[model samples]
Target: MSPQEKAGSGPAKAEICRAFSETADAYIIYGNMTDPDLYYASRFLASDSFTYILLASGHEILLVSEMEKNRALKESCVRDVRTTGEYDLRKKAAACRDASFGYAGVIEELLQKENVRKAAFPYNAPAFLYEGIRTGKAGIGVTLAKSPFLKARSIKSEEESACIEESMRGTEAAMEAAIDMIRKAGVRDGFLISPGTDRPLTGAEVLTEIDRVLTEHNDLGDETIVSCAEDSADPHGKTYGPLRAGQPIVIDIFPMNKRSRYFSDMTRTVLKGKASPELTKLYEAVRKAQEAGIAAARPGVTCADVHNRVCDVLEEAGYDTIRSGATVGFIHTTGHGVGLEIHEQPGVYDNDHVLVPGNVITIEPGLYYPGLGGIRIEDTVIITENGCRNYNKAEKVFEV
Candidate 1:
């Protein structure tokens, strides 16, 4: 088995130690909060650089700057938080093999102190660190290995699920605000005007509405999708201008909680006025397909099974999907996992991964055409023992 497949959940010290011990004596990770693995293992976040180390004994160590030492101790699960000063980092921090050299030195120092002979690093390990180790210290054996953090994160703990559900509430609230605005919009000369302003409502305004509501809940909407008419044809399309009255207005919101740092995803399509007969059919097909996808997300089911269920529903409705090698129509994965990062592991697509109880994923099925515009409905859900628990409470209303 690959290292990832053999690993356990949640980046626990024992799991980390066992995950990388087959080929090396220790495992190390280096990065900032942007590195989800770093945050997951250390439970510590910082803007600047930091390092995490795990020994074969299941002991964990964290290295950070002095300014961050106290906060690391207060926030992180790692009890052995050390500042760079003790490793003689200040002197070399200036003119090392690059900025990473100084930190790499600190990492090497820790490995030596812990009596580590061989160490494995993530596949995406910092290049400068390799240079620092190769050029500065020559004793330790280092090699590239699977991080195992992704596999660990794939199965959400009860606490992680709670954080995701909390963030999902914010996403739902923001989606509610966006739909309400579109519903109350007044149509004039084939364009949607604001309810009170009498001015044409642009895609930008809808995005603002999403962000404004997310802010109230201490959540941040990063690149939320707000597209209208033909713009909606592209899944991640971002456009601006007055919304078409009878065409689809696709709004996909993904918000992350500021404090918890967990993400939630949801999407809804609405119309300011009335949808055409064909548009209505398109919307219903996507909605039904989403239902099928959700229904197939039970434990013991493979991800490919869930995706195929969605495809069957959409195809039975006379829509072309990737199954037929079609370029357009229904052209995306059924869903994906959500956690500290927006897109995590155990994708609900063609992959053959068996669904597990703790896997939190999204069921989003969409149909898009340049001429017909687009229609999509998405919901965040947790895969339960028998079935799935949906986090979204927003109704799937096609017309405003």
Candidate 2:
């Protein structure tokens, strides 16, 4: 399913107004990114601009650079958009009679005239903008609020779910392509051999094949993970290693769809020959832990309870790997909400947040042994009234 075909309606102004009513008079959904690695933040917040327009919030401005004006208009929902360069900063500052007032005073004056009182901003708003409002001598007060707008964004509407489902499908297809390439390359004695030849595949070659397969879909931002052997010990290892017979290969791929911006994350452990007894046991334990964590997800379970359940299962199976603590079966949180953002709210940790219907979170539980490698089984799931629905379609078995 393409993003165009699955794209659905988003939250209305009235809905957002209700969500942040007590938090602020108006929500300033700002996207301040120093890099363009993740392009979805601005688009996700644009939904708020559309809601504000419908609510008639006097004016909702999306300030961007001159270069971003055209792209912003095409992608954003706000009509009253402006570029920072268009305004004369010196003139605007001079307009304020109080020399000490500065640009903050000028902006406060404009906002007060519009009858705006309090404003809420995104979690990552710039320090200058925040300090300006905090120090501004305006009689109107500006209170900072960490409104979990993304939390509300996590629970996908039917249309949003479909968009993510399609992205996940694309991700799975790419993973299949990478795995097939690795297997058919005829790896031997820790060296990958090219098809119909004895030439060895470098660590770089495996990554190139993975990147080529994923980029064919276009919406993907970067190459997916293709960790092998010892590198797999680190949850987020960056370096790649050559694949060889009997060595465990962990191929984790996550890519966003070009049109919808919704992404899919999936991991599968592979091998060209039989896995060691210890490695196989670790794999079974992690798979069981992941399944147990998923079974604990429901409408009323607390995040801590779900996490403790996985911890208990892993400990009982004697697969717990604790470093600093007395025992550490799983070091990280059980999972987190997934949607517009790769990592969202409703975190499955030892926190106190209650699970609710419509919540979509990952249930990834694993064990890692230094020098021995690690195994983790992760899947995205939607919480239902009765249970939950798993979105991943890949099999979990590890075989040559």
Return the TM-score for candidate 2, rounded to 2 decimals: 0.80
1-400 per-residue lDDT for model 2 (tens digits): 2222221124433455565557566655434332111122234223211112111242355555466678677765455556545554456557765433444544454455556666555565555555666666665555565653455565566766777787777777776776676667775666778667777754566667666666776547465666667776766654455566666667777776667767667777776667889888888888888889889998898888888888888888886533225333466777888776667777888889888777888888866666877676788888888888888887776765
Q: Which candidate comes out best when scored by TM-score?
A: 1
Report residue 1 deviation for candidate 2 (angstroms): 17
Q: Using alpha carbons, what is the TM-score of model 1?
A: 0.95
Model 1 spans > 4 angstroms off: 1-12, 94-99
Question: Each prediction's Cα lDDT score?
Answer: 0.84, 0.63
Q: Which stretches of candidate 2 lie over 4 Å from their true place?
A: 1-23, 32-75, 78-90, 93-110, 137-139, 321-329
State every prediction's TM-score relative to the real structure.
Answer: 0.95, 0.80
lDDT of 1 at 315: 95
Location of the lowest summed lDDT over 10 successive residues in candidate 1: 1-10
